[model samples]
Target chain A: MSAPSLFLTVESEGGAVCLRLAGVLDYDTSDELAARADACIEQGPRAGELHLDCEKLRLCDSTGLSALLMIHRRTTARGITLFLDNPPPFMERMLSVTGTRHLFAPESGKARQSCPDEVRETTD
Target chain B: MAPPPGIPVTRTGERQASGVWSTAPHPVLESAAGGVLTEVNPAASRLLRGARPGVRLADAAPAWLARADQDLRDRIVNGSGDTDGGASGWIGARSFEAHPSRSGNGNVVWWLVEDTDRRRAEEALATERERTAFLTEASHVLLSSLNTDRCVSATARLASEYLAEAAVVVSPARGGKLPLAHAVGGQDVVRSLVAADPSQLPGLDEALQGFPPVASRWIDPAALPAWMIPEGYTGTITSVVITPLPGQGVPAGALVLLRSGGQFTENEQIFARLFAARAGAALSAAHLYAEQSAITHTLMQDLLPPRLHRVNGVEFAGGYRPAAAQERVGGDFFDVHHAGSDGDDSSLVVLGDVCGKGLEAAVLTGKIRNTLQALVPMADDHQRMLGLLNGALLNSHHTRFATMVLASVRRTDHVVRLRLTSAGHPVPLVVRADGRVDEVGTHGTLIGALPDIESRTAETVLRPGETCLLYTDGFTEARGGPLGDEMFGEERLKRALSECADMPAEAVVERIQMLAAQWVRGGGHDDMAVVAITAPRTNHLSAVDGHTRGRYTA
Candidate 1:
């Protein structure tokens, strides 16, 4: 009966679009991330970079991970750089568990990258 | 045009030349006082040329000519009377307007005027009416079925029958390939069309741009792609109109209409679009239905129990039914695990219900099932397995939790040993051969609710012809009774089990499900799950270690 435990917010900063993902990122809420990612890519992302801030993300399930992979596929296909900024420990664990840890660029020190690199790593 | 072979027209033997005869626009046929045809204008000659021209007016003109003749006679009788009475009718395929006038010599001048535009307008109105009726029938047929293939086939058939002689419906398949979902036409025509790539079909790509229907001529068959003209296809197509089919969020497909003769008219194009719209809606519904079924299948994969296989002389059976209101898999889950791969003597079984419903609870159920499977190495140590599972749940960091009954059964030739562990789940029931049911297993706190969880294990031995059952709270919490508010509580379930004591393991599960369904009276209920293990009535083989059943009992 309660509202979904997950929420997402999108903003533009320094010529880059930042997607702040909060709360649980499980099966019920994964589609939101996918839709937002698709919109950002289609509308040119305000810049050449998309930053996913996952500091408040509490959980991620298998379906949620699949959605993330879809977002990654869309971003790279459009030549837009994607950054995983400040992912919580649980998100990191999920990424490794699903063997999709290589899709997102590693966080650089404490500063989030608005536009990182042209060369990104991906796996089949 | 020449006149017909009969009814010769001989100009009246009176004055044949008049100044007005040279320039009159409409045909003028004059008759003498005795009703004999007189002077015939050049226009009149051209108008009546297709029929018997030299005949009497009554024979040459339509039925309205008699009325005109009567008016002419009256005019001749009354000098001051005006007899230019106009009569309109059809001669052959052309419509005509005839006027009768009295001349100074008492002769009648019949002026005939053709109306081609009116005839064209009437024909167009009839075509539109037929098209509207055809479109209505097409919509009804398209909407009758939710099967995607059937809808596509019907759309193609209707398009060919009403819109064109040949038709094809194209939709995007996996990998961005556009496949022809349906094609309707003669064998030769369909073969040529089937050879063509849907994406490369003329006008189809343009229509897929979300524009209106696009009409184009198949300019050159020889210049088309090799696949477009199959070797055995001998027919030729001249015109094609592709109309895009709109879907829920995107274009569902494209409808291609082909003609062997003239180009499609403007009205035909419009009708094709309207027909495509209906076909689009039906296709969209079909796609959504397929998607929903796929999601349900995936959800049921986890919501339903694992394959119930007989293990180590012990038979296991389980059944699950989701709530009627939910078109999804609920939070209930069950699994039966054999301890070791070889001739393992012990097996572990778990049936649990997560705290919430829908996908969230389903995720938690998956986590529980996986954790239990991983802990099978420690199945011999029932308390250790429970403690490890509890720790794993606490570390999951999610709010969801579950209540489960984990039972490990070890079977000998004559008796079966069970180590039952309860995590806030229902107490395991032992059904004896004499139809006596007793509850076993200690009550424990719910799993994943808190850290440092308190769990317990109860040990019991099942003699031959005895059975044990484990279930989730869905069984007892199901509502509907004589009062309509009463829950089918544990007592009722216990009584139901007592009646099934003489049945096999599968029948026991079936009887309980029947009782629960009847208690709910076909009303709403939570997801229910039951797993029962029965020991055979007689042991046909000796026990392991070359020992008989008496050693274990003693």
Candidate 2:
């Protein structure tokens, strides 16, 4: 009857920061995501790219999408590039359907590392 | 004399009878058979005034003691043993118990023992128990209704019945006027609002301000205002106690008690305060609930979606279901704005879903709808209007974005012409007369996201018996089925739309909503909304009367 609870973990390797989101991101859990994103942005100047790893994300509703947009605004204001790393099938479809995939697309001349086969299938 | 019938002739008794009667602590009296006192000890002579030898018992002592003495003598003469217990009665201010015994001279000696302290204590305990029961019942009755006026009336009635002959419950002053509920013993409660000043009576102003009550002895009952007394209360006000009805944080009101007889004892005053405490809490809760519901009702009126109907000669219908059944408004919203009175036949129909659900999302939708309404003059240029809307949203502080579909519809002859555009929203689907469904190709980035937005508006036409369907993502994304996790998907919506060919505008909207609702099957969902625009089928025969839109024959 209720969605799976959301879990977020922050990991920094070398100069890049990765915020991994798991479980459900709906109306109830989207605010927490926004809060976590704000906290990460508060940490002083770091890497050029802030990656949101969505490999384990099961669902993202409209609210969750709004939270992602908020995070993009924060990262952009700080002169950091926000990236959608390892987006699952559903997440990729949501991004493309909402026409936000270009905002999080990989930079030019930087070959994306290990794009999911399902992403290629959907895009085709 | 054999110690007169049942009287014991013990050694101690004989000794007391011989000489100790003069120094006995309790009162002792000897009476003859005709109710005349023959002799009296020193204690008896001191206890009963006007008592001496040969005096009648009835003239010296209380009537109850004289009658008790006569009954005992009659029972003895009748050869029946005295089976009744000794009589107890108040003598002056103190209580006494009288036990009868026979002395050596064949006369009855009555011994009286004082038990005033014990009797007073028992009486106090019984009064306390009765007051406790009354307070418990008062709490139950006062809390039964959340109506503010009802709680006030109940408080007045309860105080009248238990505390005093009449009571008045004065609500907190507003605009120099106070609301009052007055109740009298064995009478119905009357409510009124009076402009009289509370400070007219001593301690009333302080009580209204939630201060501890001034003692009843300090307040003169003659100072009470005429409005404070209930009509038909014939008794003169002898004593009055004014106490504050303490509420959450502030005082709810004050209670005024009126009595025609004795002053309220310290204990009764304390008990009145206790009853006021319960009544105040109930009244405060009821007042808070009334205020909250009134505020919610006013706000919800603006956020609720309007019922769609035919606009500008084109049939328009809409259906919406919030994610939560208990909620009336949510993130999804739709509106149909008829063109200005400039003779233009086109109307702008807007449907959108804001991020999230419930009241927070509904607030955002309200902002978007207002912005769109202001931009209705630019309805001809869909791209320009969306660009302005997008700018407005980005300029604001909202962290959210919305996906919206806009359709400009106008009927020409038997066909409906439509200019459809999607702003990061689902494209409109057209259901043909023969049940063939087609998706209008329109695409754009969602509003309030990127500064430089791009959209492609598509033009289409609907023939008679054809309909255009616009919906939110909540339709295609609803997750429920035999598996309970599968998205309803665009393919399923298309298939469902294909079956609704040739149906009326309202019927088409209803069918789509029903199918999506069935798919969700009471599972968790997002806010779903749908709007249908159709060209009415021509019915020349029915149009002859011209009173109504002809019924569809299909």
- TM-score of chain A considered alone, across all candidate predictions: 0.82, 0.80
Clashes of each: 2, 0
Over B98-120, each residue of candidate 1 has an lDDT whose tens digit, in order, gives 66655666677666666757767
Candidate 2: lDDT over CA atoms? 0.83
DockQ of 2: 0.52
lDDT of 2 by residue, A12-94 (tens): 65455667778888778888888877877887336666767787888888878988888887888888878787778887778
- Docking quality category of candidate 2 according to DockQ thresholds: medium
Q: Which pairs of residues collide in model 1?
A: B8-B54, B9-B54
Q: What is the lDDT of residue B482 in candidate 1?
A: 91
Error of 1 at B383 (Å): 6.4
